[model samples]
Target: MVKKYRNFKEVGDAVVIYSDNYINDIEGEKLEDLCASYMERGFTSIVIDFSETDLVNSIGVSILIGIIEKVRDCKARIAFSGLKRVNYDIFSIVGLTKHIEIFDTEEDAVNGRVPQEMVTS
Candidate 1:
């Protein structure tokens, strides 16, 4: 099961997405759909939480990359939080972190405590 923790703040114009399993194929799709739904509702910012999720596959990685592209195309922004060391290393190797903003906490990610960038690949 995929669980989400979210906080929508008017001032920040952000939505935080918390997930315990960050990389299940079905869950990843659900998260993507959820983000798209929010984008349709005028949300311009996003934060993804992955501290509890320690596993990922190519499909999962692809989903995340897709999210980054979609948000960028819309001129919106996104941050990631609670990344486990293993997943973080994978993301780093892929250069996803270089482009996608990441925070150690949900608050920081959603509140603009981090700088935004583009995906390297």
Candidate 2:
């Protein structure tokens, strides 16, 4: 079974998924499935890049929660990068920040380094 989600690249032990411009239920589910598949294949680090993502609806956010849980259950690490400022603030306010680290660039996410200014306890 070959499934394709927007786009993705594997970096060493990490897999980076590039999200769609508009993340609705359909695209969100595709992202989830692709990430889950990679986890099943033994990817210990995952990064979902939102550089291209302009907006994500409520359903998309709900789906993201599921993906976050799945990553935890798989005992893998996950991060998000390239989020537009508004989207990043929305995610932070929605409490996704509690579960995942957000970065300004894919390189930072792949490197697993969140800028100090963005860090919050």
Tell me the tens digit of each residue's lDDT in model 1 across 35-120. 89878988888878787687877788899999989988887888888888898998988889778888888777776644433522
**Inter-residue clash pairs, candidate 2:** none
Task: Please report the candidate that would top lDDT against the real structure.
Answer: 2
TM-score per model over all chains: 0.82, 0.85
Writing each residue's lDDT as its tens digit, candidate 2 over 96-115 gives: 87668878898898887644
Error (Å) of candidate 2 at residue 27 is 0.4
lDDT of 1: 0.75
What lDDT is reached at residue 115 by model 2? 41
List CA RMSD, all candidates: 4.7, 4.9
Which stretches in model 2 have alpha-carbon errors above 4 Å? Answer: 1-6, 113-121
Model 2 scores what on Cα lDDT?
0.84
Task: Summing lDDT over every window of 10 consecutive residues in candidate 1, give the lowest-scoring window.
Answer: 1-10
